[model samples]
Target: MLREFLQSHLPQYLYVIGRPHLARMNYNELKIHILGLFEPTQEFDSLKIRELLSTDWTLKLTDKAVEMALLRYWRQGLLSRTRRAGRFQYALTERGFARKEWLLNNG
Candidate 1:
């Protein structure tokens, strides 16, 4: 059971070890990471994004920081936001998708 757990979870830790700066990412780095989290058809609110960043990326960012980034992306046309269930859920737009690809290649 321990082995299974390690096998399942080792990669996340390994990733963090490989990229120590994730723990202290600046805004542009944070934006790139947040952009990578999106799927073309999926939407995520700030809280959900924050949780994923914590667990998957090993990033410990405040709720306000994540929300502000999301809002900034929305305003920049990189993401689209909609109010649902009293929260703003954000998804990637076409421009954002293109930007993600470009960043992955050049950034």
Candidate 2:
């Protein structure tokens, strides 16, 4: 019941944040990966995320693939871009943050 509710409501929230493609991802796995990028008051760099995930997950995806994923999420409204430390940073939108909290608490 709870999972059903989340599946319905959470996507709506995330869509508002710019992550329409999130529905296509393996939600649990993607959530775990994305949560690692979060910081209380700091934005995470996109390249760092790609590198970390590539190393940790042994993904070995090309830089273009990583950039495509990032851009997709950005277009979906799940992430926002900013400049930090002379690099492009990707931060979870409010909805993305909320979804992460939900996944953590409920999963």
Candidate 3:
């Protein structure tokens, strides 16, 4: 009896919960964009990256998205990740430099 009563009380409407989605750029495009940020040698946290690229895209960009992209590049040997200022900071790797060179020449 209790189970039947609870089922009837469940709102007769269906609600779909989801996060706001953006037209995510391809990883290679981000790779090129991020490569430009590296200097002789530089490290950046998620906040710094988001701030740098915020004006480039039309849709809203979040820090978490930047972090995930950074991590993906880092995993692909494009960026080196390390702990700095109590958080993970990233720098371009040698492979990243080579990729950057290719972009500069071919792009």
Candidate 3 lDDT tens digits, 1-107: 22232223323221111424345544454566667677648888867777777744332566776778788888989899888878888888899889877765555
TM-score each candidate: 0.75, 0.56, 0.66
Check candidate 1 and list the clashing pairs.
none
Q: Per model, state how many residue pairs clash.
A: 0, 8, 0
Write one digit per residue (lDDT tens) for candidate 1, span 72-91.
89999999989999988899
Error of 1 at 28 (Å): 2.4
- Number of the predicted model whose TM-score against the real structure is largest: 1
Q: Report the Cα lDDT for residue 23, model 1.
A: 50
CA lDDT of every candidate = 0.71, 0.60, 0.64
What's the lDDT of the predicted structure labeled candidate 3? 0.64
Q: Which candidate is the best by lDDT?
A: 1
Candidate 3's TM-score reads: 0.66
- Candidate RMSDs in order: 6.1, 9.7, 17.3
Tell me which of candidates 2 and 3 scores higher on lDDT: 3
Error of 3 at 47 (Å): 1.4
